[model samples]
Target: MDIKLDAAALEAFLRAEFPQVAGEYTVDRLTEDGLVLRMDVAERHLRPGGTVSGPAMFSLADVALYLAILSRIGPQALAVTTNCAIDFMRKPAAEGSMTAEARLLKLGRVLAVGDVLLRSDGQAAPVARASLTYSIPPAA
Candidate 1:
């Protein structure tokens, strides 16, 4: 379960691959067990009710799990999300950043599965939970 991409590695990968979100996310920690990624939320992440939107949260969940999988398999950009299921359990803090903790459940040659727990900064309970399956492409 050792990470293929640590905090620094994830950051560098983001810069090289997805520059659009590089400034929005920060990798907090990565280890053999899991990875912790923090989202630097802005006013744009909120919606009409001052709650984080589903898409915004989903993106975090998706990317968090994706990064976690990559941390184990290395930078495989073609490793794409094949399936995802998420539960929106609670509303996040209106004006704060959020954190996503992701762990790989199974990593196979062609598919990787992981779960993500997302919470507003400093919150005790997760605002959302997600499970994702990624399709890993053949090494090229």
Candidate 2:
């Protein structure tokens, strides 16, 4: 699918629509596989074990897939996650920010399905993997 929004446009859309989380993530690159998003890890993102929290990683996966769909479908903030399943495979580096690579597997009229792989910056193995399904609101 053709990209409807580049990195700058996507970032702007997120900042405009989801200001609460826009600053936590950066639109790193948009590639053929999909969009790559980096989550800026802060103390709040860490768990007691000195690793990134599961929710933090899940957020990266969720947002990454959301942006991947928006990249193809335009900025549709109403698109909401309908279902999600995540697998935590490894511990993320506490000091390094995490990155999520999201690929759109299917984009239908009312639903979009995608998968995401997350890793701590510079890590070879994925820290988590997720498959997400989103319900896209009908165009107004």
Q: Write the per-residue lDDT of candidate 2 for residues 40-131, one digit (tens) a residue.
A: 88999988977888888889999999999999999888999999999999878998688999999999999999999998977899989999
Model 1 clash pairs are 4-71
TM per prediction? 0.95, 0.97
TM-score of 2: 0.97
Best prediction by TM-score? 2
In candidate 2, what residue range of length 10 has the lowest lDDT sum?
Answer: 90-99
Q: Which parts of model 1 are misplaced by more than 4 Å?
A: none
The number of clashing residue pairs in model 1 is 1
Q: What's the CA error at residue 106 for candidate 1, in Å?
A: 0.2
User: Highest lDDT among the candidates is held by which one?
Assistant: 2
CA lDDT of 125 in candidate 2? 98
